[model samples]
Each structure stands twice: as C-alpha cells, then as structure tokens.
Target chain A: MYCVETDHLTYRFARNEPVVRNVHLQVPQGSIYGFLGQNGAGKTTTLRLILGLLKKQQGIITIFGKSFEEHRLQILREIGSLIESPSLYGHLTAVENLTIYQKIHQAPKNRIQEVLELVGLSGTGKKKAGQFSLGMKQRLGLAIALINKPSLLILDEPTNGLDPNGIIEMRELLKQLQREQGITILISSHLLAEIEKLVTHVGIINQGQLIFQGTLPELMSRREQSAGIVLNTSDSQRTMGVLEQLHLGGAVESSGVVLPFVQKEIVANIARELVRSDIAIYGIQQRTDDLETIFMNAIK
Target chain B: MHLLNIFQSEWLKRRRSLASWLVVIGGLFTPVIIFTMRMVYHQRLSLPQKFQLPDFWQVSWNQSWESMALFMLPMGIIMATGLMTQLEYKNNAWKQLHTTPQRMATIFCMKLLIILIMLVQVFVVFNAGLYLFGILPSLLLSSVSYPAADLPVAMIMQWNINFFLDCLPIVGLQYALGLHFKNFLVPFGAGFLLWIVSMSGLTWEYNYILPYSYTMLDYLVLAGRKIRIGTDIHVMSVMYFAVFIVGGYAVYIWKNEKG
Candidate 1:
C-alpha cells in the first residue's frame, strides 16, 4: 500500500494563481521518495497540504490507508514532518526540545535519548538549540521528527545549508531510518545530487505543478530516448558520407561523425557498415545524461 | 492526561522566556516599591493615621491593591498574555506545533490554560510579596508595633479573587490579539492603546462599558470614588472574558494557515 497518496491536489491563494496545481503523489511504503523542486516550487505547500497544515482547497489526501480529512489526527499520529525552517525554540536545549514533543506524543521518555544519540547530539548537554550550528540544528529537527518513531517522515530540504560531510551523514541517517527502522521518508530538496544518493523513488515539481513522478531507475531510463553516438574512425569524412548515403544522417565534427543514438541494433548496424567500408574504427562512444540534464529536460 | 501533556510541553516552551520574567517582575513591582518606600520613610509612618485600624493588614492590602488594580494588574495581564500567546510565532515553531498529533482545539485550550496559570502564578507571588511588606516592617522599625489583629485571611482571599476576576477581560482581549497577530508588539501595542482609553474614561459615566476599565473601576469604586455602576463588576468582567476568549479560539481554529 502507498504510505501516502494525494489525488488531484490543487491549492491557490485567494484571487491568485494556483500555488499547487493538480498534484497527485503516490509514495510507496518503505521507499525514500525524493521531492525535487526549485525554490518556491510548491514542494513545501504540497507537504503542508498532505500533513493537514494547510486546509485543502481541492484534493484528497490519504495517509496510512486512511483519508487525511476524515482521520487527520490518526494519520498525523503516524507521520512526522519539518516544514520550511527547523521549527525550534531557541531557549530550550536539545533534550528539552525533544521532551516537549515526547510528552505531547506520549512516547517513552527513553525515546528522547535514543533520538538524540541517533542524531549524534548526545554530547550537547545544556546547550540551547539557538546556539547550535546550522547542521546541528538540522539534525536536532530530525531527532524531533523521530521522537515518536513515526511510520512516515516528511522533510523539506533536509540537507540544506549542510557541508559535504553533514550532507552525507544526513543521507546515511535517512537510509538507516528506511532500511533498519522500516520508515518511509519523503524528503524534498532542490539539489538532485543530494536526493539522488538516497531516494528510491522521485517526484519533480515545477511552477507549482508536479511534472515527473516515478522510480529512480524509471527516471534514469528516460535518458536513452536521446543520446549522441560518436564514431571516431580513420576517415571521418568517409564515415559521414557513407552514413549520409545510408540515409542515417550524421554530422562530422572534429571528433568524428556524430550519429543520433536510438538503440543497440542501430549502433551495431553502423559498426557493421564502418567495417564493410574499410574505415579503420578507432572508438565508439555514447554521451551519458546527468541528473541535472534530466531534471531540466523534465521541466521543459 | 493529554491535556496535562500539552500543558507540560507548553510550560517547557516558556522556560527562560521573557514572559516568565514578566510574571515575576510584574507581580513584585508594586509590593517591592511599597516595602522599599515604607522602609525608607519609617520615621514618618511610626505614628499611625486615622485610616489605620487596629490591624495594619487592611492598610497593607489596600496599598498593594491600589497600584496593582489601577495599573499593574491590567498592564501585567496584557503583557503576559501577549508574550505567552506569541511563543510559537516568535520561535518559528508554529508549523511544528500544528503538525503534532494533537487537535487544534486542544492546542488552543492548552495554551490559554498555560497563560491563565501564569496569571495565577503572578497573583500568588504578588500576594506573598504583599504579606512580606505587611510583616517585614514590624521587625525592622522599633517604633512600629506588630498588629494586635490576626491576618485577615478571609478578606485577603476575597480581594484576591475579586481582583483576579476584574482582570480576566483584559486577559481575554489580549489573548485574542496575541493569537491573531504574530508580532508581540501588535498585541502589546493594542493593549496599551486600550489602556490609555480606559485611563481617560475613568471618570466618565459609562466607563463600565469598556472591559479594560473594569480593573480600574473596581479599584475606584472600592477607594470611595463614585461611579454609576455600583453593582458587582466581576459579572461584567466575566462576561467580556467569555466573549473574547471564545472569539479568540474561533479565530484560531478557523484560520486557513495555522503557521
């Protein structure tokens, strides 16, 4: 069953354009769903709507096999989230902060120590959360989210403002939550590289609309639809002419004849012709697509 | 049980906050001055005046309640409610709190309950401070004799209850403003503005109409200043408090964006 689902979710400010338009999210259970979007792309809005922080204007949100509207408290009890900034009281210490949530959630007092240790904030005794570094604060937020041992976790830009080491640490922690604790996480970030390392599923939102949603492999497979096959041979001009004669148009650049890549069979055919034409084949290379390129193309 | 949990959480949020300081400071402000001034002018007060009955407890209670009811009670209520209600917004934790498993109504009521409890705490401290002012002077000055009469427990408690009742409407109004606005200054500013209005209308015939004026009017009526409504002011104070507190809750619950 999907851990969280939204159907035709649409929200707009009064007398303004839609901030979140027609978003249908299907986050599978036990998967790290990366919610990718640029700043103000409604990623936060969508998360808020699903958490019932923002009243639904037009949509249906279901969490843990129950309707969010009808069973908001029940759904919320099993979910944990940190939207926008890390919502923390600067005056309280790390344990004090988590204790507040613990009492409210009625979780065991020991869970506070467990989450603090899990977040590597065990040594931060009596230091107010306001004095914490940005990375520390982010971890503290994660600790609070895990205080109740939630089944589903939603985090907005969890790796934001973190150094490389902090990012990796956070990524590993999220992976541990999903793998060891069997928690489902939906983490939103503008950095695909950040999310790419940990997300099992992916959703891309642009201009307040969800443009792409699928598994990581499904997103990776989209690259095959367009790639350039470069053939470097002893006689590049001859290879281009022969390719043009074959009606498989090719452009001859300084590298060689660049052919439009379609499939393995097409590449095999080109190699077979190159050998028949007596052109000494030096190398054949296909340009790979990066995630940024895929993300940009998806938005377009 | 959940209410207690929320209450504990709410109190934790207030730890080391200015609202907590305001309670202690506001509660002690008048009594401290009363104690200090009496100690400084001990020679002059050695001879009791015509108003001094056998028991000086009444005098001490009057002096304590005089400034408190006229100014500090309402102002303290305004400031405390404003500070307590704006805790989430100030910390940027409203969204975090809103996402918790608790219902919105429960959150609203628990926060209100915390603020009200703080108000009670301030009264507790102030009452202690007044008692100190009452008994401490007899020990220091040789000319001043300890009162022959026992501490008028019933009268003191009655006055405490009445004064608390008088200040409820201010709490309600300020709490409403506190919920509606994110800035502490908005509620603080609006409260001060209403306070000025209440002060100006002190001698007016219909001063009772203003909920903010109840504290002062109750004080004035007790101090022998004639006002139109000599009836019980607690009822009026309570009625206004009910309206404002319920109105604040409705505004809070019905809000589209809780954070």
Candidate 2:
C-alpha cells in the first residue's frame, strides 16, 4: 500500500481561488518522496492537508491503507510533521520543549535526549529556544517530529533557512533516517537541486496543480528526451521562416534557435538548410539533460 | 490515558509562564494593600474619645473582597488567560500541537483545565494572605481600640469559596477571548474595558446578567454594616457559573473543529 495517497484533492483559502486544485498524489512505502514546487505553489497547503492540520475541503486522503477522515488520529499517530517553520516554545529550553511532546506522545524520558543528539542539538543545555539560531531551531523542530518515532515524516521546506553546511547536514540526516529506520518521508522543497540527491521519487507542483509525478528515473528519461540543439543564426526571424518551410520546428531563444535533437542527421540537415537559405550561422551546440532543466520545463 | 497525558503536558508548558507569577502577585495584592491602608489610617488620625474603632476584622474582609472583585480578579484572570494562550501562538505552536494524535477537544479542555487550576491556586493564596497579613497583624496591635473577636475562620472560608464561584464566569469569558484572538492586546484590552463597565453594572437594574457583576452582587457591604449574602444572589451566581462554563467550552470546541 502507498504510504500516502490523495485523490482529487482540492483546497482554496478564498472564494473562486483554489490554492491546491484537483490533484492526485501517490507516495510509495519506504521511499523518500521529494515534493517540488516554487514558493506559493501550494506545497505547504498540501502537506498540511495530508497531516490533517487543515481540514480537507474536497477529496479522499488515504494513509497506511485507511481513509484519513475515518482514521485521522490513528494515521496521525504514525505520522510526524513540521510545516513551514519550527513550532517551538521560545521560553523553554530544547530539552524542555521536547519533553512536552514526549509526555503528550507518552514516549520515554530518554527519547528526548536521544532525539536531541540525533538532531545535533545535544549541547543546547538550558538555553531558551528563543535564544537559538535559525539552524538550531530547525533541528529542534526536526527532533520534535522524530521524538514520536513515526513511520512517515512530512517536512515542508525543512532546510529552508539553513546555511550550506547546515543544509548538507540536514540532507544527510534525512537520508540516514530513511536508511536506518526504513521511514517513508514526504519532504517538500522549492529547489529541485537541493532535494534531487535524496529523493527516490519526485512530484512537481505548479500553480495549485500537479505538473509531474513519477520515479526519479522516469523524470530523468523526460530530461533525456528534452535534449536539443541550440543554433545561433544572424537572422533568427528569417531562420524560423525557412525552418517552417522545410517542415522543421524550433523556438527562438536568446542563445539561438533551439530544435529537438532527434538525430545527428537532423543537425546537419538544419545546418545545410540554413546555409542554403543564406541565413548566416554563428554557432551550434548541444544542450545536456539534467533534473534542473527538466524541472524548469515541467513547471513552465 | 491520553487525557491524563494531555493534562500533564499542559501543566509542564505553563510551569515557567509569567501568568503564574502574575497570579501570585495578584492574590497577595488585595490583602497587602488593605493592611497597609489600615496601618496608615491608624497612624494619621486620632479618634474622638467616645468613638470606637470599627470592627477591624469585618473591615479587612470587606476591603479585601471588594478590591479582589473590582480589580484584582478581573485583571488577573485576563492577564493569566492571555499569557497562557500567548505561549501557543508566540511560535505557532498551536499548529504543531494540532498535528499530533491527540484530539483538539482534548487539547482545548486540558488547557482550560490548567487555567482553572491556576485560578484556584490564586484563590487559595489570596485567602491565605488575607488571614496571615490582614487579620493576624490587627490582633497583634494590643493598643488598638478595635473589638477582639477570634479570627472568624468559618466566615473567611465561606467568603473565599463564594468569591471563587462568583469569578467562574469571568474565567470562562477570558479563556474564550484569549483562544479566539491570537494577539494579546485584543483580549487584554477587552478585559480591561469590560471590568470598567462591570463597575457600573453593580448598581444597574439587571446586574445579574453581567458576569463581571456577579462578584460584587454576591457579597455586599451596606452603610458600614457587616457584609451580607442574600439567597437570590447565591442562586444567580450558580446560574452564571453554569452558563459561562458550558458556553465557553462550546465555543472552544466549535472553533477547534471548524479550523
């Protein structure tokens, strides 16, 4: 069974404007699903809906083989989440903040220290959380989510405000958690480059709609097919007219006219056709396929 | 089991809050102020030879209860409720708490329960201070011309319990306001303004309708006579208590589920 599944899920904060439109999501069990979107792309809203933090406006949400509405508390007990920013008590110390959740979840006292050390906050002794730096607060939030030993963890931009080293540490820590505990994680990020290395599956969202949802290899294949040739011509408008006459299709870009790299012969044919048309050719180069390019294209 | 865990968590969250300190100071304020006023009055004016000092114990109890009902209880309840709810909103902790396995109803009830417990502590401390500082000091002044009656332990206990019951509606009102509004100033300002309005409510014809007036109406000091409690006032106090408690809990649960 999928760790999380939502069918025709939709949400709108105001009238006539849905923040999360009709969308279907599938997260395979034990896989790190990277939810990719730009800022204000309904990433956080979707996570909140999945975690039952926000009331689902329309559609079905199923987690661990049961309906979320029918078994909300049971599903929530197995899921841990950190949405937007860390929700912490600034007046309390790191350990104290964790202790409150520990008592609520009925976890043992020792679990607080264990999660603290796991999040690399073992040294924040007696310092109020308000005094903590942004990175430390993020760790503390992660630690709270981990304190319950949930099977599924949903984090919305968990590495949002971290420095380079802090970002790397968070990436490694998430990877380690999935490996060691076999936990299924649904982590959202606006930057594909940031989470590409950690996600086994990817779902892309744009303007409240699911643009792409598939395995990493499936996404990579799309990128492979997207590889094209960039040709710089003296008369971009005239070259476009000539290419249309020859049944060739391409788009004008700042670098040049870009056409699909269907075959090596096509590149030669285009070069010869442009020469015969007397359209001055400046340069020709092949563009490589990567996740970043695929993500940009998919969103666009 | 989950309910107990929630209660325990709520308690721990409030262990170091400013509301607890405010409650402590609020509880002691009335008695200490009354005691100092009596001391200064005795020091300043010499009485006529035939005039006997008013019943000192009665005077102390009346002043303390009046001060408590008029200012201390309203302000304390407002500040305490605001402070407790502020901790949740300060860092958006309400969102975090809602994501847990615990039900929102349970969480809301547990928080309200904690506030009630804190108010109870304030009540107990206020009474304790009244007896310790207000009554004991008067007895020690051998040269004073007041009547020497043994401390009316039963009367004092009755007054404390009555005032506590009378203040329940305010507790409910403040808790509802605090949870409904995230900003501290809204609830605090509302409570302050309501307290001022409640002062006029005591003399109004429909005083029973106002929750804030319940404390003043329940016990009264008329023309320097000993404080009196009427049967109608007791009945009205119970009704106000029941209405506000039930109303507040309904508002809390409705808002939680609707969100």
Candidate 3:
C-alpha cells in the first residue's frame, strides 16, 4: 500500500499562480522516496501539506490510508517531520530538547537515552544545542523527529548546509532507518548527487510541477534512444541549414552552435559544411548522464 | 500523563532559567533589605510606638508578604510574562514543545503552572528570610517594642488569602499580554507604566479596570483595614481576573491557530 498519496493537490499563494499545481505523489511503504527540486520549487510546501502544517486548498492527502484533515492527530503521532530549517530550542541541551519532546509525547524516559545513542549524540547530551556543530544540530533535529519511533519520516532538505561528510552520514542514517527499522522516509533535497545514492524512487519537480516520477532504471529507459552529441560548428546558422538539408533535425541547442541529433554521420557532414562556410570549428563531444545536466535538460 | 509530563518539563526548565531565579531573588530582596534596615533603626522607635511600628519592615510571614507585594510582586509578574512569551517567539521553545504529541491545553497549563510556581517561590523565600532575620532574632534575643509574631497563622492566612485573590488577575493578565505580544518590553512596559500611574493616582480612578491594580493590595493594608468580603475591591478583582482568564484562553487559541 502507498504510505502517502496525493491526488490532484493544488495549492496557490496567489489567485492565478499555484505553487503546487495538481501534483500527484505516491510514496511506497518502507521505501525512501527522494523529492528533487530546485529552490522555491515547492518541495518544502508539498511536505508541509502532507504534514497538515499548511492547509490544503484543493486535494486529497492520504497517509497510512487515512485522510490528513480527518485524522490529523493520529497521523501526526505516527508520522514524524523536520520542516524547513532546524527549529529547536537553542538554549536547551540536546538532551533537554529531547526531554521536552519526550514530555509532550509522554514517551518512556528510556526512549530519550536510546534515541540520543541512535543519533550518536549519547555523550553530548548535556551540551547546549546552540553549541552543537551545524551537522550535530541537524542530527539532533532528526533525532527529535525519530524519538517516537514513527512509521514515516518527512525531512525537508535534510542535508541542507551540511558538509560532504555530514551529508554522507545523514544519507547512511536514512538508509539504515529504511533498511532496519522498516520506516518509510520522504526526503526533499536539491542535492541530487547525495539523494541518488539513498533513494529507491525519485520525483523531480520544477516550478511547482512534477516533471518526472519513476525509478532510476525506469528513467534511464525513458531516455531518448539516440545518444546525445554536442557539435561545435563555425557557422551555427549554416550548420542548422545543412542539418535541414540533410533532413537530420532533432533539436539544436546553445545558440545553434551545438546541435544534438540521432545520426552520427550527420555530424561529419555538418562539420564539413560549417568549415566550407569559412566558420572556425572549436570542439565537439557526447553528453554523458549527469543529474545536473539531466535536470537542466528536463527543466529547459 | 501528558499533562504531568508537560508540567515536569516546564517546571524543570523554569528552575534552570537564570532569569527566573533572578526574578525570584529580586522579589525577596526588598523584604530582606527592609528587615536589615529595620534592625538598624529599632532603637529610634519609642517602646509604645515601636509596638505599632507598622509590620512594614518586620520580617514575619504576614508582614514580609505585605512589603514584598509593594514593588517586587509586580516585578515577579513582569519576569513571568517576559520568560513565558519569549519562549514562544524568541527561541521557539514553545513551538518545539508543541510539535510533540502533547495537547495544546497541556502545554498552555504547564506554562501557567510555571508562573504560579515562580510566584509561590517569591513569597516563600520572602517569608523564610523574615523568619531568619526579623522573627527569629527578636524571639531568641529580646523584644524591642512589638512582640514578634513569628509564624502567626491567622495573620499569615488572612494576608495570603488576600494576596492570592489579588494576584490571580495580574498573573492571568500578564500571561495573556505576554502570549499576545511576543515582545518582552511591550507587556512589561505597560505593566511598569500602569504601576507608576496607579501610584501617582491619575489612573487610580480607573485602577479596577487595569489588570495590574490588584497588586496594590498592600496599599489597603497600609491604610490599616481588616480583610472583608463583597467590597468594591473584591468585585473589581473578580472582574479583572475573569477577563484575564477569558483573554488568556483566547490568546492561546489564536496563537495555536496561526504559525
């Protein structure tokens, strides 16, 4: 069963402009679903909607087979969240912060010690959270969310502002939670490289629209059959004219200087034509699979 | 169970706060200082006159309470308002705690309990200090004029009864203003300004209307009046406290509705 599902979820800050527009999302139980988006792309907004932090204008959000509005408290008890940046009491210790959370939840006192150890914050309990390193603070925030042994964890930009080592640690912890605890995690992150390692599924969003939703293999299969080639030509206009003359029109990018097409022999003809047009040739290459490049390509 | 947890956590946190401690100590300091001054000036009073030396400086439970309320009672309320409201906005401690499975009612009541505890400590310490300096010394050493009424049950109960009734509305008002305005200065400044105005008698005409006026209970005691019921003071205090309780709940609901 889908742990979380959103059907035609539409939310708008303005009358005509929707920040999250009819977005459909499915998160499988015990799966780590990576929500990929650029800044201001409504990733955090979507997570808030699922958590019922923000009111849904139009849509149905079901978590653990229960509607959010009808069963908010029950769902909230079962699902943990770290919304936006880390919101914590800076003056309190990591232990004190968790203690406060523990009191509110009426969790066993032993749970605090266990979660502190789980987050690798066992020895640093008494140290004030404000004195913690940025990475430690991030982990403490996550630990607070995890204290109740929640079935689903929703983290918004969980690794944001962390160094490479911090990112890796967080990534491994998320994987461990999913693998051992059988907890489902929905992580929203702009750092595609980090997410690619931990996520079982991905949903790429841009400008409030989910452009792609599939597994890694499915996405690769969806790629165009023809390998992409970047051709540097002197007369970009003449090269385009030659491609049309040769009837090899796929798409021309980069001010018409770089032409991408399916046919390889077309490059030789196009290169020869550009040289004959008295335009200097610089370089040419094939496009490899990279998230940055793919993301640009997808949004563009 | 959740309410108990909220109370324990809120109580422990308040105990750890240096600001809360400062207010508590500051609340009792005036009584302590006055007791010291009274010891120095004991010789100045005529034996007959000293007998009625206005339990003002006497460090007994009843008299110390009267003196403490004169200035430090309001100070304690100011500190409570500052600490409680600032927790919600400045550090988001309130928000962080609210995120847990605890109900808002529990958290809100825990905060009210913290304020109540602080108020109790202020009075308790004031009484303790009086017993040490004003009452104990007089009973052990010698009586100057007035017989030291240490641990005077009837007077203590009467005084505290008036104090609790008088303090209820102020606590409630401070809680409401503090929660409503996240800024420490606005509510505190308003309290300070009202205290000054009521002392000056300009706003004393509308004293019953202002929530902070009940802290002026000592003024009635200074005028040599016995505690009575169904007076204008009692009626006004009940009205102000009712408003405070209703307004505080409104603020709590309003705050919870938003971010």
Best candidate according to TM-score: 1
For residues B1-259, write the lDDT of model 3, one tens digit per residue. Answer: 6567768777656545665776658655865675666666666643334444555343344455554566677767776656766765666544345445655566667787787777777667765665555543355336553453334557665666667667777777778788778678988887778667655552344555555656565445544555332346656777887888687876676552223
- Expressed as tens digits, the lDDT of each residue in B147-258 for candidate 1 is 6667888988887788889888998989889999998899999999999998898777777777888878877766667677645678988999999989999988888987
Off by over 4 Å in 2: A227-234, A239-249, A253-256, A261-300, B35-42, B45-55, B135-149, B219-238, B256-259
Each model's lDDT comes to 0.86, 0.81, 0.71
Q: Which ten residues in a row have the lowest lDDT in candidate 3 chain A?
A: A218-227
Model 2 docking category: medium
Model 2, residue A239: displacement in angstroms?
4.5
Structure candidate 1, residue pairs in collision: none
Please give, for residues B1-259, the per-residue lDDT of candidate 2 as tens digits.
8788878888988877798888789989988886676566755543221124445566567767776877778778888988998888887898789878887678877888899899899988887887777554446565454345556678777877777777777777778878888889998998888777877766666666666776766555422434433345656667866776677667765552232
List the candidate 1 regions with Cα displacement exceeding 4 Å.
A224-292, B47-55
Top candidate, metric DockQ: 1
Q: Model 2 misses residue B60 by how many Å?
A: 2.1
Model 2 gets an lDDT of: 0.81
Please write out the lDDT profile of model 1 over residues A1-300, one tens digit for every residue.
Answer: 999999999999887999999999999999999998888889999998888888899988889889988888887788888887798889899999999999999999999999999989999999999999999999999999999899999999988778999999999999999999899999999877778879999998888988899998887677555467889999988898778767797788776777777578878888899899999999999855555556566876
> Which candidate, 1 or 3, would have the higher lDDT against the true structure?
1
Reference-based TM-score of each model:
0.89, 0.87, 0.84
